[model samples]
Target: MAVSPAPSSGHLPRTSPRSPWDAPPGGAPDPWTPWAGPEALRRQDPELADVLLAELRRQRQDLQLIAAENFTSPAVLAALGSPLANKYAEGYPGARHHGGCEVVDLAERLAVDRATALFGAEHANVQPHSGSSAVLAAYAALLRPGDTVLAMALAQGGHLTHGSPANFSGRWFDFVGYGVDPVTGLIDHDRVRALALAHRPKAIVCGSISYPRHPDYAAFREIADEVDAYLIADAAHPIGLVAGGVAPSPVPYADVVCATTHKVLRGPRGGLVMCPAELAGRMDRAVFPFTQGGAQMHTVAAKAVALGEAATPAFAAYTRQVVANARALAGELSQLGLTVATGGTDTHLITADPAPLGVDGPAARRRCAAAGIVLDVCAVPAPDRPGGCVKGIRLGTAAVTTQGMTEPEMGRIAALLAAALREDAGTRAEVAELTGEFQPYP
Candidate 1:
């Protein structure tokens, strides 16, 4: 395998490879040729393909720690590039707004049915363009405008769609938020119950983007029942683990569940909504016409392919390994004097308070990027109590673990992170060397 160039310190550009679709030196077929979509740049400026190819190579070679990013299988990628992309199949199967969509509709229906089976939901809608779109549809189905909603506070490991003031969910409806217990960095179910009783929200949305533990969907159900509110589980991050029976599933407790097919599911970028039988019609209506039109049939096909994979025993083992890897990484980080949230993780992500290490989330993310590891900058909010600081940086083991990384890899990654924070040049070189051609799950 060939190695990509190393990222330089202090001035590393955001790394991305444009394409990996070309045949290698021996003229053999490129392994990734099937999924490499039409090169928008290659068609317009042929010379740019080299740069894009370099970027793609860098991504494969580097350590991907982004909580929401991963490498999809070639099978799923092939489906994404299929002829389904050309179809404009509006409406459900056998009820399309466009003709010549028979095969496309079948492909999409397969995706919906497979997703329903995978999650054990009564109905599934695989059309929302992204996780945020899927979430909006769920909200639209369950709440009227201005209805009060209870969701996890963003600064405390919640998603933007859950009720961030700057997001559409907060703008369109009245939103109240609950947070993790500051001392333990874990969600306080008692606090959630208190808030639900006080607010009597239309829906209690449960899930997070940076949280380090499995959400208690059953508990959220109890809270919602007490308040006569609906339970919406946005299991976008842990859906794969849930499906593999490694994490507690929300299907039994949630009236509506939303997820993205990427991340741990390892599929093409797309979203899905799974609801109980009672909300089938409303959820469908919310997803269509209300949120979007003309579903991306290609992506839906890819989603079906991925969902099929998720049902396999291998995928189950893969999901378990991801959580195990996360635990290993968290333990190592904690040993390195970083404050890992919740002490450790029950899922594939972990959060650390970088303030004690003399850095902020954005700066830490950039430093990791420069050292050939990628991460997202997370928000930390003000507290009712005084003398609080930002929550810090978040990381995940999904991508690296998928690349066949184990405890040793986790330790190396953690050490690289510490060195990056300390501005140690030797550690960055070691990271680049260790990460060469490290494709997860290939």
Candidate 2:
């Protein structure tokens, strides 16, 4: 095997063999290639192959501004598509229920170690299937069924896992919902503290899906301390930024931090949980036997790759650009007659009301879809007497930044968004023209 020198940047460069594979010294068969012929899959299953390829085309041709999404590196994709997917590792690295787990064990260990290092946590579990799964495990480890917990209200920019009436958390636990300040679109620490004292929750959860500003971990810790509650930080949206050192880490303050690998982390679509050493055992067990079954070894390996990439200087630089691009885009949105939540952003996420531009969030989302501008619709905190009534659009810079877009591109995107919201004809062509310069796959 040839060992080429590492690239100048942290990102692993993708490699492809020539059309003809080289013969071995003993004239042995050629090694397996990363990619099979394009027709190989189509021949077997044309319908599914078309769906997959069409998805690829859609991703490559549109602006991916969804805050919960990002483009994974080719190296990470390679890991996801590797033979490790065949393994059924059911437990942690050292202990497994299945045989032939030795190799996959090392992959899991690598993922755990890299995750801990990336976010400066004492312990990490990289096996949970998704961010929601990670949070479920965190709750399982810390609280019993029916224990009173405080979490952001779902209508107030909180995630579904955070006390949604439709989720397990809402059903199994006695949850007290908190909301952001009606005027500022930011969390009101005073109100949260009051709620904590009033409810005396067993745990206080701090995190959100659409909130644009960074959470005050220390403040939440203090409030939780006063109430004798475990503090759980659902950092699914900001973990990638935290890894890049562009955002504050919750590992130090929250008893357990739950995150997703995909968002800004630019890894596989998986979940990660980090905590202090004392809680490691419970967190692991919760993820393994309690919430989920066999671990997806391939996703674990991809997470390891992503965590390593995140620790690199280049990834840090990329995260910084992600934030900068978000701030610039928020300004552009504000100038284009949109009411930007918090007036601007401190992270890769931006929440704005397109109602000022003659379309509500859902309408704007439909229009943006027609224009091939990918983003999400979210519930915004009512900027008046806070009960959650306003609907708005949410955008993230991670995906576009991953495509090598910058502030100027953000302005163009915001312009395109405005034109689309206004129902201008021929806006999708402009969007296609812009996206053509930044193909996510190419």
Candidate 3:
């Protein structure tokens, strides 16, 4: 057969049409194209897609006041769903067990670099699957089984992983608990020192889940030094604030800092551990071979994106607004006859005992949910009562701040909460109108 005698130098003879896997005339795919979303899920499983869409609608239509919640960016969401999720990188960046970790190594490295930069820490391990896991890893790194640990009381704004009787920490360690002052509803430094001096715990943890004020990390460090204990700051709720420079950082004071990426950081649901450079190896070992297996590379990539976002000036403004909105909400609640814990909030959350409004915490939360305002029931500083008693409602402004609400909007939300607690007939309509004005995902 006569071959095409001579194909032109610039233009070769075409053999076949382009396949779906082939790139376009350009070198790479278009980045702006909508790659994955509800439509893709709908195509695969319509029922699950509907549920997700309904959840999106619910989030858009209702207020989210859960203290440990926030709305992440679309970029972070994209990172969470990226192809990196397909990989299984079982160890730290260069030392991973798997063969195809070059790209995942870059992802994890970027996450670690960004986290360390954001927090001004010596080292970072962005591997733990959740905040609780981060705390577990920190414990594993610092303490041995049956070692004494002094942590805040769970009923007084402390987290379960800090040493609740039902948790692994409590079961494995000899945990001595401290509480905030019943009168101030804030941590009592004297009491903490007393307990630390008395128990001489191996580790002293200072942080809270529902606390509404800035923690005295300096004092905690002093106490820890006096007792020769390792100080751990479980800053799950305030990492974004610390990164933005609007709140005090525990990195300089604590031996190790544990945090969740999603809560205030507004990233994917993941965890981070930052510590002094000297302890980096121990922390990494604890997180990988001890607490968890293969790191979630996708979430680590999302965390890198969030840390990048948080380092910008715009995120600083957002964090400042979050604190302002929280203060405004607490003031409004007090004006509307609610007893705000600590009189008001210095952070992004307001813990209020609704008893002054003639409603229990659970009842107030239910009423607010019915009126399209979401929050969580919390325990107050009631030493006489059991830990399960619903004594307060904890509300946060992180999600609302992400929705672009301000001080004026906080006032309106407080009014809605007040009216809802009282069962006013028009409160639900007001909530619907307000939520329509500020869509969370829009």
lDDT of 2 by residue, 16-99 (tens): 653333334563433333334244456556799899999999998887889989999988988987768889888877789999
List of clashing residue pairs for candidate 1: 16-55, 17-55, 17-56, 18-52, 402-440, 403-440
- Over 114-217, each residue of candidate 1 has an lDDT whose tens digit, in order, gives 99888888999999999999999998888988999998877676788977779998789888889887777778999999999998999999998887788888
Clashes of each: 6, 0, 0
Q: Considering TM-score, where higher is better, how would the candidates rank from best to worst? A: 2, 3, 1
Which candidate number has the best TM-score? Answer: 2
68 in model 3: Cα distance from truth in Å? 0.8
The candidate with the higher lDDT, 1 or 3, is 3
lDDT ranking from best candidate downward: 2, 3, 1
Error of 1 at 197 (Å): 1.3
Distance from true position, residue 238, model 2, in Å? 0.6
Instruction: Give each model's whole-structure lDDT.
Output: 0.82, 0.88, 0.87
Model 2: residues with Cα > 4 Å off, grouped in runs: 1-34, 37-39, 384-386
lDDT of model 3 at residue 58?
88
| Ten residues in sequence with the least summed lDDT for candidate 2 | 28-37
Q: Report lDDT (Cα) of residue 245, candidate 1.
A: 83
